[model samples]
Target chain A: MTDTEKVIEIQVLRYRPEQETEPVLQSFKVPFTDDMSVLQGLQYIKDYLDGTVSFRWSCRMAICGSCGMMIDGKPKLSCKTFLREYYPAGLRIEALAHMPIERDLIVDAGDFITKLESIKPYIIPKEPRTLEQGEYLQTPQQRDMYEQFSSCINCMLCYAACPQYGLDKTFTGPGVLALMHRYNADSRDGASAERMDLGYAHEGFWGCTAVGYCSVVCPKGVDPANAINQNKMNSAINYFTRFVTPKGGTK
Target chain B: MSKRRPYVRSMDGWWKRDAYFVKYMAREVTAVFVAAYAVVLLVGLVRLAQGQAAYEGWLAALKSPLSLVFHLVLLATFVYHTWSWFNIMPKTMPIMFVGGKRVQPGMITGAGLAAAVVACLAVLLIVRGVAS
Candidate 1:
C-alpha cells in the first residue's frame, strides 16, 4: 500500500516511570493494511518510528492470553482487534483499566496472579488413586459439565471490564473465579471443601457485585460471572449446612 | 523470642478494600434492599386487609416526607435490582437455541423489562377499577 493508504493515525497513552511521573497521550501516523491487527500497527511503530513505545504480545493469535489492552475504552486482545474495524478514523489505545500502569501498555498483573493462587486452582481427587488404576474414568456428560470454564486462557480482559476489580485489587476477580469453577466442577476433583474456604470468605464470593461486565468482556465465552454467582449459591448452602451436618459434612 | 512469619489476614478488612470481593458484596447489599422493599409492601397489604382506617394510616405514613424520601431511594434501588436481575437471568437459565443459534443477552433483558412494565401497568389498571 502507498503512504496515503498505509497511513493510520493511532493515539497511544505513554508512561515511563524512570523518566516521567504520569502518562500522556502520544499520536503516531503509521503504515497499516486492512489485513493487519492493532498489534501489528504497534510493532510497525516500534520497528520504524519510535522504540520507547512499550506493550506485550505472545502467540500473535488469540491463544497465548497476552496482549490485552484497552482499545477505545474497552478491554480487548490487540492481536485479535482488527484495524479494519476502526479504519478511516484514528484509534485510541491505552493500558487495561483498574490496574496501575508500569509503563505504556503494561499494567501490574501481580494481584491477578496472587488471586489465582488463593483459589487453590488444582484438582484434588475424592479418593487416592493408584497408578495401576490408570486415568480416572469420566463420562462425556461429566466432561461437558466444566468444559466451557476450561476454555479460559487467563486473558484478564474480564478484570479490566470489572469495576469491582478496579476498586479492589485483592478481590480475586473473574479470571480466578472461572479457574476455581473449572476445578470445582471436575468429576475427579474432591477439593471443593479446601477451595470453598477461599470462595466463601467476605471478599471472596460475597465481594462480587455482579456488574456482569466480566462475562461480556470474556473472549473465550468462559462466563466468569456465572461461575462466581454459582459459587455464591454454593457458599450460602455451605454456610447453612455446616450447622446441620456433623464431621464437616461431604461434598 | 520466636521469629514470626508475616501473615496477611486475607479476610480482615475485605469490604471496599478489595475489588474482586466488592462485586459480590454489592450484589448481597442489593439483595437486602430487595428484601426490605418486599417486607414494606407485605406490611402495607396486611394493614389494608385489617380495615379501611388501618389502610389509610399506612397510606398517610407513606405520604410523610421521610417515608417519601425512603420510597424514592427504594425505587432507585428497585430499578437497579430489576436491571441486574434481568442481566443475570440469561446466565442461570439454559441457553435459548433456535435454528442452531444461541439467543443474545440483550434480547433477554429487553424482553424481561418489557414484561415487567406490562405487568405493572396491568396491576395499576386492576387497582384503579377496583377503587372505582
Candidate 2:
C-alpha cells in the first residue's frame, strides 16, 4: 500500500448466475510493473481485489492459448499482452467476443470444441502401413504445403475475431478450417475427398467473407484466412472437375 | 443447483466497430461503381446501334460537366477496385511454387497490378491507333 506506486485501471466484464441478469463491467485499480501481463492483472484482481473473477489460463507463456479475451474490443492472448501498453488509457477486458458468457471473463467454448472435432484435426493415412514398412517420409517442399497452417493452438481467438462467426455461429470458423487444411494438405493424408465434403459445404469454408481479421489477431500467425480462402478455390475446382476426374480435385 | 443463463451479446452494427470491416465494406462498395460503369457502356452500345443521331446525342451527353465528374469518380473507384481485387487474390488463390520456392504475397499483388497497368496501356494505344 505505497502511495508512490504506479497503478493501472482494468475493467472486467463480470457475470454471476445468481447476482446479475447479464454481464457487466467492474473496474479495479491495480499496481503494475512494466513486465506485468494482462493475465497477471486479472490474477491480481482475483487474488486480492475480488475472489469471484474467473478466467482460463495455463502455461503462463502464450503456448496454452487459454487466456484469450476481448482486450479493448480486440481478441488477444492476455498472457502475451502487457498491461504497460494501456497504462494511462486503461483496458476494458471482456469474455471472448461473439460467444455466450458462461461467467466472468469465460465464454462457452462448447461450440468451438464441436467445430474442432467435426473437422477431425488428426491425420488419416492414405493406406494402413504395416509394421515392416518404413515411416512416411515427405520432402521439404511437401512439408511447406501445410507447414504454416499447423501452428493453431485452438485458443478460439480467431473465432472471436471472425465477424462471420459472430454473425452466424454455424460457420466452420478460421482456426478449425485452418487445421482442416493442415491435415488435408499433408502429403501422406488421403482424406481430402472426405474433408472437402465439409469444406465445400455451405457452412464450411464458403462461410468466410474473408474479412481477414482472423489472421491479424492470431498470436501464432497461423493465417487461418489464407487456409480457408485457398480451400475456396480448391472447392470450386472440385465441383468443376468431378465429371472429368473420377476422384475429383479435392485430392 | 439453480439453472444457468448465459448472456449472448447482440452483434448489431458489428462492422462499424472495426476499421478493417470499414475497409472491407469499402472494397465491396466498389462493385457499385463497376456496375454503374457497365450500365454506361451498355447504354453507349445501344445508342451506337440506334443510329448516328442517337450516338451523337450520347457523345454529347458524355461531354457534359456532370458526366466528367461522374467519370472521375468512376476512375477512382475502378483503381481502388482493381488494387483490392488483386491484393486479396493471393489469399483467395492456391499457393504457388516456382523454382522450389513459394511465391511471396507481395509478388502476386505486384504481378497482378503490373499486368493490369500493361493491359490498360495496350487498350489506350489501340484506341489511339484506331482513332488515327
TM-score of 1: 0.76
lDDT of 1 by residue, B1-75 (tens): 632222211324435543534655665577787888888889899999999999999999989999989888888
Q: Which pairs clash in model 2?
A: none
lDDT for B7 (candidate 2): 84
Query: What is the lDDT, from 0 to 100, of the residue A32 in candidate 1?
Result: 77
Instruction: Give the TM-score of each candidate.
Output: 0.76, 0.95
Candidate 2 per-residue lDDT over residues A32-69, each given as its tens digit: 98899999999999999999999999998999889999
TM-score of chain A of each: 0.95, 0.96
Candidate achieving the largest DockQ: 2
lDDT per model vs. reference: 0.80, 0.90
Which candidate has the top score in lDDT? Answer: 2
Residue B124 in model 1: shift from native, Å?
A: 7.4
Candidate 1 per-residue C-alpha lDDT over A1-251 given as tens digits, one digit per residue, 9 for 90 to 100: 56457677899998877666577889999777789999999998899889989999989999988899999778899999988788778799988877778778888777888888788888788887999989999986677667788999988999887766666766888888888888988999999888877788766767787677788778888888888887776777778887787855444
